[model samples]
Target: AILNSCEYGEGWATDTYEKALKDDAEYLTTEQQAMIKAQHALLKADHDKVKSMHDTLAEIA
Candidate 1:
C-alpha cells in the first residue's frame, strides 16, 4: 500500500511538471530543465520518505 501511494504521488508530480513545462515551453531553456529536474528529485525523495514512515508506523501497530 505504501509503495502504491508513493508511485501514485510520483506519477502525479511528473504529470504536473510536464504540464508546466509544456505551458512554458516557449520560455523554458536547458538551465530551466536542470532546475526542474533537481526540484522534482527532491519532491520525489520527500514523498518516498513520508510513505516509508507511514509504512513503518503501520507495521508497529
Candidate 2:
C-alpha cells in the first residue's frame, strides 16, 4: 500500500471515499476455508464435550 501510495495518493490505504470502489480486501482462499470448516467441526465437538463434563461436575458439586 505504501509503495502504491504515490500512484494512488496518500490516505489511499484508509480511504473509504468510494466504499464499493475500494478494492483492498483480505480473506482466506476457498481451499483454506474448506480446511478450516473440516477442522472446525472437530474443534467445536471437543469443546462441547468438555463443556458438558464441566456442567455435570458443577451439578454434582
Candidate 3:
C-alpha cells in the first residue's frame, strides 16, 4: 500500500520550509511580517467601525 512506502507510515512529514521553521521561533519572517501588518490595518479599521456603530446605537437608545 501507499502507506508502506512512507517513512512515517502515512503520517505527515516536515519536509516543507514553513513547517520546518514553524517551531524554530514564533517570530515572523519578512513576508509574514508584511501580511501581519496588513491584517492589523484591517482589524483597526473594523474596530473603528464597530466603535462608531456602538456610539450611534447608544445615542439612539
**Among these predicted structures, which one has the highest lDDT?**
1
Q: Score each candidate by Cα lDDT.
A: 0.77, 0.46, 0.48
Which digits, one per residue and each the tens of the lDDT, describe model 2 over residues 1-61?
Answer: 3323332442342243223223422355667556555555555555556556656766897
What ranges in model 1 sit over 4 Å off? 1-15, 18-27
- Model 3 compared with the native: what TM-score? 0.54
User: In terms of TM-score, which candidate is strongest?
Assistant: 1
Best-first order by TM-score: 1, 3, 2
- The true-versus-predicted C-alpha distance at residue 31 of model 2, in Å, is 1.4
Tens digit per residue, CA lDDT, model 3, 1-57: 222334232123223333434554367677875665565556555555655665676
Q: Which one wins by TM-score: 2 or 3?
A: 3
Estimate the overall C-alpha local distance difference test score of candidate 3: 0.48
Scored against the true structure, residue 60 in model 3 reaches a CA lDDT of 91
Per-candidate TM-score against the hidden true structure: 0.60, 0.53, 0.54
Give the per-residue lDDT digits (tens) of candidate 1, residues 41-61: 787787677777777877998
Candidate 1 TM-score, C-alpha based = 0.60
